[model samples]
Target: MAVPALDTARAAPHTRPAPAPRPARRPGRAAVALAPAGLALALGLWGIRRENSMWRDESTTYQVAHRGVADIFHLLGEADVAHGLYYLLMHGVFALWDGGLLALRLPSVLAMAAAAAGVALLGHRLAGPRTGLAAGAVFALAPAVQRYAQEGRSYALVCAAVVWSTHLLLSAVANPRGRAWAGYAAVASVTCLLHEFAVLAVLAHGVTLLLARVPAPIRWAWARAASAVALVLAPLVIVSQQQAALVGWIGRPGQTELLGFLALTAVGLGCAVLPLRTSAAISLRTLALPLLILPAATLLAVSFIHPIYVDRYVLYSYAGFALLTGAGLEAALRAAPHPRAGAAALAAVAVAALLPYSIELRTPQSRLDDPMAAARAVRELTRPGDGVLFMPARRREPIMSSPGEFRGLKELALAQHAVPSGTLHGIELSAPRIRARMMTAERIAVVTDPPGRRPDDTPQERTKREVLAQHFRRCAEREVQGMVVLLYARPGAC
Candidate 1:
């Protein structure tokens, strides 16, 4: 006999009760993703104008990019071979608005913002959302990042490109798509072109891939992509190598730098080894360990053969450092009784720690030399018909960015304008010619490097000093931010 069917419709009202309240709609992923970019932009732009003076390197950027396109290309072949792409990019920027220090540095600020976002995305992909946010926050607070973000340089741009390329690499491995691999190669090549040292990042990528032991298809894709990048970058490498003397000033790593590097390594390794919940297919350690260690380690090892281990050259490694730090911090926060409060406290501490460094980065003393201050001093002291001499010759770079200050004062040693001469400072006159010019000048204004620093001692530089000392007496001297400006007159003329 069929059992009487229960009146399910009648019982539904009592049994179903109130539908569980739908979880409140959280912010969209896209909105959350924008947080890193927004934060980076804010930090980078803050107090950017406070350090309005251009430094020596930034003066070079200004002088080089201000030249005509053809002149820039010509100069690239003879000097600054490694910075061709960056100069070209800056050329576009200056073309739009060559106004104040802000125009000069805005590109770097935007690039840093992009880099922070890319770092966040990389961390998110490798670990989780909290780690990503933490990584981006740490990157924004890094003193080095803050320093470069407000300077007119290629480092920040290179860093952004490298971080994005790593993100593309993750995507390529996850999907094994040809388009994804091509994108990775394109970005990697662009990054290397921005600064040839960025090519070292490939070795870091190699370590990651090897450790992962990815599928044959993915491995092949990576090989093809890497090979393409290398082939595209070969010409730049060879050209930059020929111009290796550009970095001759870099000495071997000092005790302080080495010790600092060791400390960084210890911290990175500690974070990498920490137990944290991460994707099974891709561990945070596998992704971030190589990036944090290998580029710097390889560069340092090569420094024995050639002293090319500048901390700024491997600045992109900081992204990896941030990732590891973020993951460790996230794990800590998660373990706390109140995760949200723990996170807030950690963030507060980070901000407090970085506040001083952030302020320091905005000061003229933070850089090697303040060109604007030097120019202002020169303008105040110089008189009509006064002959200007650049002791060591390269010190002329400050005036190159402020040609108006030197207008009416003859450049006693200049053979040609910097663009025409295709040199950082204008090509100097012959030693005899420089001496003759100095002898004829009734009054001369001299710009020299900081006190206690030895001059370059080239024949022309030595002649400049010798002629001034023998024929003229120092009437007055003013110490500018990173230079000494002196007024010299014929003996007894003062």
Candidate 2:
């Protein structure tokens, strides 16, 4: 009996020294990881709440789409631009949710959060849980990430899709089974539709399969799936062709913008790869290389032909680059004979990077006075028979681009005023020109942004301000929320 008991004790699963208690997840790990994303959300919410005063580009989104979702769809089929799908999605979201700044901004917030979670998961899977956690934390705190989170744009969505698709790719490559493959295919298709840069994901996957020696059958399946996507996107490529002229107008960025873009790209990708530095040295560098190098090169090359050089056009690359950088950072630490020293150093650097961002975002004033409050205030001041001139309004015309587009300046103007009927003009004419033209009107608000240069200005357009002083016996200008609205009335007309 004693001998038998001895044998059982020796065979017990716990016999190997309690298997070194699993490393306690870093203290307050969940909270620490979540901090960055929370900060981003808070900042984003505060940022867009105001009379953002429709930039010319922003104005266009409103004009046509405001008519109805159906109208947006029709525009997409006819004269829509590269961002049509995203614009379409926003059109529906706005129509259903009332198109408030908060509502339009919510989608980007969700996307940014989704991206953070995906980064963590990818980092964990690529290296270990600890690595994943660290990478995710850094990503949430990145400044570039915060900037895009509040805007009603597609960059945040593209970022999320890229990170998530990468996570799916990790699973698919490892298992390459029905569910994994299906997930990969579905995500890839959606990503492609969201932004064409998603095609780079397929290349990344191919590299991963090659490095891992995935089964031949699985590789062949991935190839077929990619081929199907290429075929579907072929039409989009043709569309890209038509847009070439418009896109080409954006010349190679000036030196400063290019430098800033490169820095942000580095910061974004660095966060993604920092957590997964072990188990697969391949996870960080190799994955990031194709994403960072190829897509940028391709876009720049095409810019020569098609002109798609906006940073957001390749926003998806930021996620992949972050993952790669995180992996590299983690791997360098693990490679050390004593990883504790390297880990401490990494943790310190991460803290340093995140602290500034956290502080900047926590303060709303730094982001600027609440825009939403200002917009609402302006609306209240509006009264019937009052003409509000958007002075130097031509620059802001892009924000309100179409005079009658759905989500553009027209909607904003209509929402606030009872302009039963009149043309909304974006002219350089001074207060006198406006006052003289609408002599019957009792009050006139000449609205315009600060001065900006133009290639050409009509002779009458110049010195209109000096001319206004001469014609309008009584003229007063007040800065209403950064807009110079000069109210002109006859000497006794007030």
Candidate 3:
């Protein structure tokens, strides 16, 4: 009565109530957000036990982190300065649970999962929700991502930090605030701290900022954030440079590397040209194209002056590749008559393509050297008190990682044990001392680098070879993956 019998039909037009708030969209949004992390964890945990043995690089991680923290810090100064931060993180991991291989590699698995989530989130911010889901899924399934996800190394962690930092960067650029920029700086600094090469991601960010039509304030904020990150990372960069000899083994980029880069460029370009929806303020092409190409290109260009390019060093670049791949697939599916079916078919093809590589990664052959296999071979062949020799001196590394396999045997050339010496391979005795010890042993076991590697021509190595030749006969020889084991005994005394 007070409302005068209200104009019901007119009110109906005005007060439709926003279409009931669309509860259905909430579930779909949640699924898209969570899918990437779920796929990452499932794939990461699938073959967690397949590669049971630690490879040489992973063995180095285990040995280094297992050392007392002080010893690890001390060793970092002399060698492995590049992995110092990762080792320190692992030191804490081992302290909580020393449950062998699983314990050592679990952190990487978790880190990669977080990285997958971040990749999805970044893709979503750059392109859309569908692209984010696709990108994250692609990242989880990429061969390199799967490889590092299962290995005990810093690359996966670095990739995670880079992806999240990129996400933070997008946020900072859109809403230029002190706190947002500071968050970007902190996350990027951590990424650089994990692996100094990750600082190259900032260059990718710079390219994104330059290409985007952002306001001056946002660009200046990004520049300030990047400068802060560099300042924080400068100390680590200086220390890592002083330890440059650690990477001396990396030769100039070869034909294989060039081919790989070309392939990556082709893929990124293909994605950029696709008719994907992107914001005019900051296009996915602007961000993803540079992120995918520049870091590796910059590293390769610099390699002409100094050979610093290693594929794994720029592993975070793969996240960009993944994002591009995701966007490309989404564009193709959207163009198709049936988008969901197209997406399913595309996913199935991706899984089929990745299956073989995934299987190969689980095998011992995936690694350059299997220290665990070497350790097992040694354990099977040797008896207590058999003298051991590392032919090139560096071959001692595998044994050092599994000292228990060599517990009762005498390390004929070792001047000090790795743990006691705080070194990777323990120091070797002088040439004279090594030769003298060789002559007295009735039986000795030798571990050598794989056959056909250039022989070590150093005096100590020469003396080692000569003494074994003159005083003993090869009683038995067995080859293990990435190594050779020879049993030597006095003439007529097998």
Candidate 4:
């Protein structure tokens, strides 16, 4: 008998109904999710204070968040508009409790914990309980995750939003409904607002939909949801683009970034080919593989023209890495002759391997520089009424967050305080004004990037250096991580 045409077969009766929008609730799933989340929270809290140290980036968060609401809003219009939402959220957090360092970092810790739980639940829904648990564990143990989990920045929260959004996107695809689509759009929109790079994840999700070959109607529903997200995010995109100088520091992808992506790409491809059993209506490989590679790959590609790729910008991709790893490990466990023992051994080995890295993350030295340490150095070297100068102006950040340390030391070139000026480092005097001011001081302390750092060529910075070198003698100098503190005395004053 001749087979019916493909279109005729599709139209024939008794076609399988689309799967339910959500997986059936299974017992112990909550417990499975909690295990990994708790682990992540514990790890996050482990070094939350980083020995009471905060780096330059965290100092920016602390100082920005400490400003009045109006000041923060005003600052965003001029710079850092991309981080506006996160800075506002942190402002609220600091308002509730001014517990200093702990308060600054707790939101990120909690956000990462939520991300861990979302990864687990997503894995469990797509694969099995074992895969879910393993994935969560893998996500929690990642060194990069641990590093960012304790940071005050928005990356951790952004990651959490994207991961949960991916799970919701899966729901919309499984059983296309108006409410499901709405939920996906709302969460996905929040993810992009948190950090614009997260919009790439939405593109990755589109690829997954195409690979799964959802019905035309479902595809259109997804398109609508994705469009809604874009509409919601459009304003931020436009505003942030006008302020694109914020990311000017980003450079073309380096060897480290290229090698890292290639290695993970190979691993993700390998995981996709592995034998696996999962409950997902569409293969987990299709979802996880695209999620793992697309966002970072797209950023890397774009960096060729304009360098906007930063690993932390697409940190949510690690959730995809964890899911693939979990599925692969779960499959291996089952294939072992003694599954329980093999799994236990595997856990032990992972812990052993990650322990040293975990310990290193908790140290102050792990960060680029300790802002507090630099502050202490400044405080120790300068006397009240002595003049203090920040070379290149931006070095003011290290001492800006700890005003008490530099109290009474005249800021020789500052025209206005940072918060009052609604700028990060505040306005500086003109070159002539700075030179005249330097002549009046008997002693001056200058904070600068450590020796061998390229000097700023700006007019203000050049005048500061020229006057110091020609008129003052270097009486004493101290080098701290990421900063140098030098005390200069007028000739014969030392």
**lDDT by residue for model 2 (1-494), tens:** 79999898889876666556786555343553465456446555654643343333344445544545555554554444556678778778777886555666689887888787777666666667666655675576566677667656777988888777776766776677878877777778777877777787677767767766767887887887788778777787687566555444477655655686677566655655444445553455556556665666566766656556766676666566556656565666667897778778877886698668645643433342232323333344444555544334333342333222212112112222111211122223444554354554555545555345342254434434444465554455544433444556657755
Candidate order by lDDT, decreasing, is 4, 3, 1, 2
lDDT of 2 at 470: 59
Error of 2 at 94 (Å): 4.0
Worst 10 residues of 1 by lDDT: 24-33
lDDT of each: 0.84, 0.58, 0.85, 0.89
Candidate 2: give its CA RMSD in angstroms.
7.2
lDDT of 2: 0.58
Question: Comparing candidate 3 with candidate 4, which one achieves the higher lDDT?
Answer: 4
User: What does the lDDT read for residue 276 in candidate 4?
Assistant: 75
- TM-scores for every candidate against the unseen true structure: 0.94, 0.69, 0.93, 0.93
Which stretches of model 4 miss by more than 4 angstroms?
1-27
Which window of ten consecutive residues has the lowest lDDT sum in model 2? Answer: 414-423
Q: Which prediction has more favorable lDDT, 1 or 3?
A: 3
Q: Which candidate ranks first by TM-score, i.e. highest?
A: 1
> 232-306 in candidate 4: lDDT tens per residue?
999999999998886887999999999988887887777777897778777778788888999999999999999
Clashes of 4: 0
Q: Tell me the lDDT of model 3 at 261.
A: 90
* C-alpha positional error of residue 429 in candidate 4 after TM-score superposition, expressed in Å: 0.7
Per-residue lDDT value at 214 in model 3: 80
Higher lDDT: candidate 2 or 4? 4
